[model samples]
Target: MKVKELEEHPTFAAVLPPATSEEYDTTGWRAFKPVVDKEKCTGCLICWVYCPEPAIIRTPDRKIEFDYKHCKGCGICEVECPVKAIKMVKEV
Candidate 1:
């Protein structure tokens, strides 16, 4: 496969040979989870853009959603959110 083409779908693990656990259900080890305050969200997508893992999703209604399955609880989303809509709360 061409390098450019491969880069286009870099996270499509099924088609890629070297897939890691980063793209799987790694939530059990997390100590915290980022909760988005929808009322405060401005939909700027800063959190979505800065996420190292594909855990932050932009919904069709222009809302941000979290997929904890692959989230490592890095808090990058919470930090990047300009409106401070996301808060990292301890997981129970």
Candidate 2:
């Protein structure tokens, strides 16, 4: 698939290689989830870099995406975002 098409039609497991985190679905482990505010996001990639689970995905357009299946909702993304673009909201 072309880069543009891949960005538009994101497939979580395809983005990363097989690994420890990828082996299991960790989505249910978090009480909260990080939501990005596009208006405030500068695409600085800070959150993407600091995520321990490496759940953040940086798109070709410089925007950010998430691999929630492996995300633990550790809140590091929200805390590390300099622009405060990421907010951790309670997961319903």
Candidate 3:
């Protein structure tokens, strides 16, 4: 059960499947979209920069935008936003 032992096991390596676009497509529907409260926002771009999916965008004036198409709704941006501007709302 040690970390080193697990790393050396072929079974662990065999458990994972090879990457494919189908895998990505199938999971696309599960992604969440973030809702921003512009009234509460201070125009900070913390959410824009911290998003792992690059779902957040920053305008020339530092306004924030989210592209729900590619966003997995991981909530990292919402948790990292200093001004509490981003809220992770479940996608319907």
Best by TM-score: 2
Model 3 residue runs over 4 Å out of place are: 1-31
What is candidate 2's lDDT per residue for 1-92, written digit by digit as tens?
78888779747675655565567888899999999998898999989889997899988989998888888999999988999999999998
lDDT of 3 by residue, 1-92 (tens): 89999778676334555644323532365456688887888886777767776667776766877776566778888888888888777766
Query: What TM-score does candidate 1 reach?
Result: 0.74
TM-score, candidate number 2: 0.75
Off by over 4 Å in 1: 1-23
lDDT of model 3, residue 1: 89
Q: What lDDT score goes with residue 58 in model 2?
A: 88
Question: Which residue pairs clash in candidate 2?
Answer: none
Error of 1 at 47 (Å): 0.5
Tens-digit lDDT track of model 1 for 1-92: 89999778758446655766655678986899999999999889988889988788899889899988888899999888888999999999
Question: Which number leads on lDDT?
Answer: 2
Ordered by TM-score, highest first, the candidates read 2, 1, 3
Worst 10 residues of 2 by lDDT: 12-21
The local distance difference test score of each candidate is 0.87, 0.88, 0.71
